[model samples]
Target: MLQSIQIMALPLQDLKARIDQELDENPALEVLEDRETISLDSMPEKNSEVESYFENSSDPGFSSSYDQAAADSKQSFMENALSKPESLREHLIWQLRLQPIPEEFFQIGELLIRNLDENGFHLEDPELLVSQDQHPAMKEMISIIQRFDPPGCCSADYIESLKIQASLVVDVPEAIYPLIEKHLQALDRGKYRDIARAEKIPEEEVLHCLEILKSLTPFPGREYSSAEPTYVIPDVAVTRENGEFRIMVNEEEIPVLGLNSFFDQVFQESGNNDQPGHAEAKSFVTSKIRDARWFINSIQQRHDTLKKVALAIVEYQRDFFIHGPKSIVPLTLKNVAEDIGVHEATVSRLTRGKYMQTDFGIFELKYFFTNAVTGTRKGGGSYGKEAVKAIMKEILEAEADRHLSDQKISDLLEKRGIKIARRTVAKYRKELDISSSYNR
Candidate 1:
C-alpha cells in the first residue's frame, strides 16, 4: 500500500520509469497498445466456469472506462512531446570546427574545453599546458578561445571573466576594470565610497561604474548549459470557470494495463488437464492471475485516492485559489487527512513532491500548508506565516528611498496588527534574499 501511494506521488516522467520497470519484472502485467482494448470478448473461454468468472469480474467495466480516458488523452500526450535543448559544449565545439586554426591547435583547444568547468572558468593552470617551445602559440590559442561567443569561455575566475567581458564593450568606463581587479571584495560588500577613495574618483562616478559592472555575467558558460532540463508535469490542475474552482487530475500520462490473453488462455487450459505436470501448471497460473488482479486493483486505488485528496485540498483552500497566496489560511496535513478520512501519513505521502497547477501559478501541494502566527492584540484573528511573509515582502518592495531596518519593519507589521519580532523579521528577510538596511 505504501509503495502504491509512493507511486501516486511521483511526477509524470518518474512514474513512467517506474511503470517500465514493473512491466519488465512482471510477466502478468502488460500495457495495452493504441489499437488494442481489453474486453471480456477478447479472452478465450475453455469452459462454463471460466466464462462465468469473466462475466462476474470487474475487469470489463474498468477496461471500458480506461478506453474512454485513453481516447481523450491522446492529443495532450502529443502536445507534451517536447524537443531536447542544446548544451554549451556542443555550441563551443561547433564554433571551433568553423575556425581556420591549425589542425594541431584543435587538440590544444579540445584540452582547453575539457579543463573548463560548468561556469566557463578554466579549472587547470593554462601555463601547465605550455613548455618553453609552444609557449607563445598556446597562449594565443587560449586567448582566441576566450573571445568566443560567450565572451569569457576560458577565464580563470569571475574577476578574469568580468575583465575579458568588459574589454568587449566599446565605451566601458575606465574605473570598471580597476574596480573589478582591485576591490572585488569591497564591491561585494556594497562599499562604493571605499572604491571612490582608492581610485581618486567621485562617489557618483564609482556608483556609475558599479552599475556597469553589474551588467556583466559572472558565469557566462551557464547561459548555454548542456544539461538536459527536467520538465514538471502537474498532477492536478485547478481552473476557475464562472467563479467556481474545478479540480482535474492529470491521468493522461498513465497507461492502461491488463493481463495478457495468452496467459489467461493457458491458465484456463491447465486447470482442466489431468496430466503429470498439470497440477503445478495450474498453481502457477492461478498465482499469476491473482498477482495481475492485485496489480490492476492497486493502480485503480491509487487513482481514486489521488482524486479524493486533490478535491479535499481544493475545497479546503478555495479562498487561496480565488484571492492568491495572501488569502491562504493556516492548514496542516492533519486537517486535510481528517477531511479526506485518511491517515496523516497517507496525506503526507500523497503530497510529497506532488505539484498542482492553479490559475495563479504552479505550486507544490505542501506550499498551501502553513503554520498559524497568532496576532498580538486580543480578539484579533491569527495570521498564516506565508501571509506574513507576503506582507513583509510588499513592505520591503515599497520602501523606495528610505531603507527600513528589521526593527522598523517589525514596528510597521505591529501597526498592521501582526506583532512579529525584529529577529523574526530579519530571518524572514534573509530567507527572501533581501540585504540589510546598510547594504541597501
Candidate 2:
C-alpha cells in the first residue's frame, strides 16, 4: 500500500520512466501497444481512410486522435517539448565577444565570465584569476562582464550584484545604494521600521526602497540557466459542454501492458514440472508474474484514483469548471476525500504533481484545494484564498496608477462583503509578485 501510494505521487514523466525501467528489467512484462513516444509531427499523415477509422475506432487508444477533452493535452505536450537551454557561461561569453575591446582585455573578460558560477557570482576571486602583468586589467575585465545582458554577472555576491544593478538604474534614489550596501539584511528580515529609524528616512521611503530591491534579480544568471525546462503533460482533463463537466484520465501516455505469452506459458508449465530445480524455476516464475501483475495493477489504480479525484473536484467546484478559476470556491483534501469516499491522504497522493486541463487553463490538481478565507460576508458565503487573490489582482491591475496601499485594498475588499486584514492583503500581494504601492 505504501509502495502504491509512492507510485501515485510520481508525475507523468517519472511514471513513464518507471514503467520503461520495469519493462527493461522484467522480461515477462511486454508492451502490447504503446503510443507514448510517438512524435506527433512525424505521425503517418492521415489518409481519408485513416481519418474515417479514427472517427469510428472503438479501440480506446485511438482516443488521442479524436478525443475532444484530451485534444488540448496532445497539442500542449507536443508544443512543450523543449530544446537544450543556453548556459550562463554561453550567454556571458556571447556578450563578451561583442564588446570590441583589446585582445588581452577580451581574454581576461572571458576568463572572469568563465570563473563565474550559475548564479553569476565569482567561483574564484577575479584578482587571483589574473597574472601580475594582467592584474591592472582584471578590474576592467570584471566590470565589462558584469555589465552584460543580465546586468550584474561576475560579482562577489548577491549584495554586490544588487549594488551594481542599483548603480545602473536611471534616476535611482540616493537612499537605494546605501540600503543595498548596509541595510539589505534588515530589509530581508522585513524590519522596515527599524531600518527607517536607523537610516533616519521616512518609513514609507524605506518600504519604497524595499520594493525596488525586490525588483532586482538576485541570481541574474538563472534567467539564462542551463537547467532543463520541465514539460508538464496533464494526468487528467476536465472540459465543460452544455454547462456540464467531463472528466478524463490522460490514458494516451500509458502503454498497453500484458504478460508475454511465452513467459505465461513457461510459468504454467513450471508449476507442473518435476525436473531438477523445478521448485526453483516455479518460484522464480511465480515471483516475476506476481510482480508484473502488481505493477500493471498499480498503474491502473493510480489513474483510476487520479480520474476519480478530478471528477470529485469538478463536481465539488462546478462553479470553477463552468465559470473559470476565479469562480473556484473554498475546498480542502478532506472535502474531496469525503465526496469520493477516500482518505484525505489518498486524495493528496493522487493529486500531487497531477495537472488538469480546463477551458480556463492547465492547473495542478493541488491548485483546486485551497483554504477558505475567514471572516463574515454580507451574503454569508466564504471566499477561497486563490479566488481572493485573483480578485485582488484584478482590483490592482484595474487601478494601476492608483497605487493603492494594502490597507486601502483591504477596505475595497470589505466593500464587496469580503472582510480580510490589511496584513493578509499584503501577504497575498507579495505572493502575486505585485510590488508595494511605493514601487507601483
Candidate 3:
C-alpha cells in the first residue's frame, strides 16, 4: 500500500519512465495499445511511409504499419529528451577562450568564472581564491572576467556589477554612480525630493541619470540563465461544457498494458511439466506473471484514485472552474478525505505532483488547496488566502499613476468584503513574486 501510494504521486513524465522500466525488466508485461497523436513538427514528410504511434489516446481509425519487432525498435528509437540551456559558467568560459591571454591568466579566469554565482557575482573573495603568489594574477583574471561578454560578471555584488559595467561602457552619465550607491534606495521609494536635496541636483537630472543606468543590468549573467522551463503533462483536465464542469483523469497519457501471450503460454506449459528441470522455469514464469499483474493493477489504481480526487476537487472548487483562478475557495485535504471516504494521507499523496489543466491554466492539484483567510467580513463573508492573493495581484496590475502601498491594498480588500491585515497583504504580495510598492 505504501509503495502504491508513492506511485500514485508520480507525475505523467515520471510515470511514463516508470512504465518503460517495468516493460524492459518484465517480459510478461507488454504495451497492448499505445496510440499517440503526432504534432506537426514530429509528423513525417510528404510521400514518406511511416507508422503513427500514440500513447494513451483512443483509435482514430489508423493502424500500425510495423510488426511487433518493428514496433519494439520504433519505441526504442523515439526517446524523450529534455533540452538544457547554456550555463553562466559556460558563457563566460567560451568568451575567455577567445581572449588573447597567457595560460596562467586563462586558468585563473576559469577559476574565477566557476566561483561566480547565478547573478554573475563572485561567491568568494578573489584574493582568497588562490595562493598569495597568484593573488596578482587572480585580480587580473577578475578584471578580465568582469569585462567578459556580459560586461558585469566576476564582481562582489550587484552594486559593484553596475559600477563595473558603467566603467567599461561608453558615455555613462557622471551622476550614475552616486545615484546607484547613495540614492537608489530613495529613488526606489519615489523619494526624488530627498535624493535631489542630498545631491544638490535637480529632480529631472536625477531621473535622467537613472534612465541612463537602466541600459546596464545589475545581474548580467541572468541573460544566459541555464534554468529551463519545466514542462508538465497535466494528469487531469477540467473542462466546462454547456454550463457544467467535466473532470477527466488523463488516462490517455499512459499506455494500455496487458500480459504477453508468449509469456502466458510458457508459464502454463512449464507448470504442466513434471520434470525437475522445468521447476525453475515454472517458478520464474509464475514470479514474472505475478509481478506483471501487480504492476498493471497498481497503475490502474493510481489513475482511479487520481480521477476520484479530481472529481472531488472539481465539485468543491466548481466556482474556480466556472469563474477562474480567483474564485477558488478555501479547501483542505481533511475536507476532501471525508468527502471521498478516504484518509487525509491518501488524499494528500494522490494530489501530490499531479497537475490539472483548466481554462485559466495548468495548476498542480495542490494549488487548489489553501487555508481560509483570517477575519471574516460583515455578514459572515469569508475569503481563501489564494483568492485574496489573486485579487491583490489584479489590484496591483491595474493602471495607476503610483504604486499602491500594502496598507492601501489591505484597505481595498476590506472594501471588497475580504478582511485581511496590511502585513498579510505584503506577505501575499511577496509570495506572488511581486516586489513591494517601494520597488514596484
Best by TM-score: 3
Summarize candidate 3's per-residue lDDT along 328-373 as a digit string, tens digits: 7889999999987888988888888889999999999899998987
The parts of candidate 2 lying over 4 Å away from their true place are 37-86, 91-111, 124-152, 158-223
Angstrom error of the Cα, residue 126, model 3: value is 4.2
Two-way lDDT contest, 1 vs 2, winner: 2
Model 2 residue 100 lDDT? Answer: 78
Model 2 lDDT, residue 404, Cα: 97
Model 3 stretches with alpha carbons more than 4 Å out: 37-87, 123-132, 169-187, 190-213, 374-380
Global CA lDDT computed for model 1: 0.81
TM, every model: 0.75, 0.74, 0.81
| Of candidates 2 and 1, the better by TM-score | 1
- Regarding lDDT, does 2 or 3 come out ahead? 2
lDDT of 2 by residue, 314-415 (tens): 887888877776777899999888888889988888888888998988999888999898547656688888888989998998988888999999999988
The order by descending lDDT is 2, 3, 1
Ranking by TM-score: 3, 1, 2
